[model samples]
Target: MEGMVVSTDAYASQVGLDVLQDGGNAVDAAIATGFALAVVNPEAGNLGGGGFMIVRNDEGGVFALDHREKAPLAATRDMFLDEEGNVTEASTVGHLSAGVPGTVAGLWEAYRRFGSLTWSRLLQPAIDLAAGFEVRERQVATLVAAQNGIRQFESG
Candidate 1:
């Protein structure tokens, strides 16, 4: 392979490159790239989000890892509804709407089964990138968009 990476976010692609260059396999690159996404693309890549993973071993065995987040233990079908059964705004906004996170656990599970590099080593690229990133105009625009979304939920 020529070692090419294609990602919507450049930083994430770089993270993948770093992992692969470090002698890590695809699973390792995936884990590191996912972590880097969480830092560089927080709007959609936060740890609070969960996702699936598919891995194929050299022997051709394939495995799917389901890391999608689940509702909190305290959640219920009607928890966000009012007495009259109308959906409350709480059901879709603010902290109350958040589900339990599962990304880290899912990544760990996949790595344990299919990884070649140490987990800590794979994570270092993301951590270093996060520590060194300087906010740019694009990120400022993202913040403005996020602020508008937050304003929509604000009572005052």
Candidate 2:
């Protein structure tokens, strides 16, 4: 509160600060902020990566979460390999490149421990955005340029 510069476009930083201002702990703020960012920028800030969290309590109890993601057990060494061991385009796109997700669980733990509001409260902003806004101009242009490819991908 004294002197901190929240980076622009970083919802986590702002959210953490907001939670602190409301007397909530670090975990509460991080969860709220992480959700906001993921919703606003799914193409980039995704729920795909794993993260660890460290916690400190009033009596100096320290807790840690090793929330990192590991490759699926069903995965084989040749999962992305072509017959010749080269990566196939199909392996890198569509369903293949998608990693296991942990964002939801992380957020859930944070909310459970530190959130005062309902889950509905955390999701309202995203709901409002989707139900009532225009795509950005840059996104519109990109879509227009690749309309055929995108259409085919979605339809496929």
Candidate 3:
């Protein structure tokens, strides 16, 4: 069977295609594409976030994977409220508002269930991209536009 991959970034799509061409199944291609996006499309793709995946095998078996981020055990409904009980920006920004990241676990689970390629093989493309890749004009613009927002936090 033939497979095709489309993503927001050309580099990510190419990574997926490379996986498919190298005898990887759809799940493996998706995993590679996702990791590549984390490096090449940071504005929308990130390892710190969670996502969902639905797979249908050639035998007509369907599976749903939910890898959504989970709130910390100590989180409260009013955790983002200020002293006056007004909503604060705390929930929308900073480390205190972050959820337990589930992307890696979710990807691993998907691979365990349906992937054919080795995990390291699927991750190599992303690793190469992260080590060094050309930054295009669009990416430069995006980084420039986001600099101020990213600079607001200490981690930036």
Candidate 4:
């Protein structure tokens, strides 16, 4: 009679559950979960990145969504390699490495097709979390690990 939600991050999972409790459908809860992740699990939340999703409705109908990021207009397949044909470090780091994000668009599409809640309503939890969610021990640990890893890539 109720609903359930799950995710890698506890806070994000809670947000999704809250959305469901608030009358959101699976797609709406998923969008809320994603936005919550951006605040609570930035390392992988990647608001500026893209991904894929597969959904199955209660009617036995299934849908596949390709939200994979598009390469920037200027990008070329060979861009990741240098003159020596070795993979260049630059190919995978910094702005040049990024592609056009599709996550938001994909989420919106899903919500449009299957959601029972308003888009703005789904976004509110994430907004609230960003405004005041306190940093927890696990989050701190993740941040430290992320910092250490990123520092290794710094040239100076």
Instruction: Sort by lDDT, best first.
Output: 3, 1, 4, 2
At residue 59, give the lDDT of candidate 1: 94
lDDT, residue 88, candidate 1: 95
Q: What is the lDDT of residue 44 in candidate 2?
A: 46
Q: Report the lDDT tens digits of candidate 1 across residue range 49-103.
A: 8999888888999888999999998888999989999999897788998889999
Q: Estimate each model's TM-score.
A: 0.87, 0.65, 0.92, 0.88
- Indicate the residue-level lDDT of 70 in model 4: 92
Worst 10 residues of 2 by lDDT: 1-10
Residue-wise C-alpha lDDT for candidate 3, range 1-156, written one tens digit per residue:
498999999999999999999999999999999999999997777899889999999899999999988998989999999889998988888887799988989999999999999999999999999999998899999999988878997552
Query: What clash pairs does model 1 have?
Result: none
In order of listing, the candidates' clash counts read 0, 0, 0, 0
**Poorest 10 consecutive residues of model 4 by lDDT?**
1-10
Model 2 Cα displacement at 6 (Å)? 4.2
Candidate with the greatest TM-score versus the true structure: 3
Per-residue alpha-carbon lDDT of model 4 for 50-130, expressed as tens digits? 878788999999999999889888888898898889998776776688789998898888888888888889888888988
Kindly indicate the candidate among 1 and 2 with the higher TM-score. Answer: 1
What does the lDDT read for residue 33 in candidate 2?
60
Error of 3 at 119 (Å): 0.6
The models' CA-based lDDT, in order, is 0.85, 0.61, 0.92, 0.84
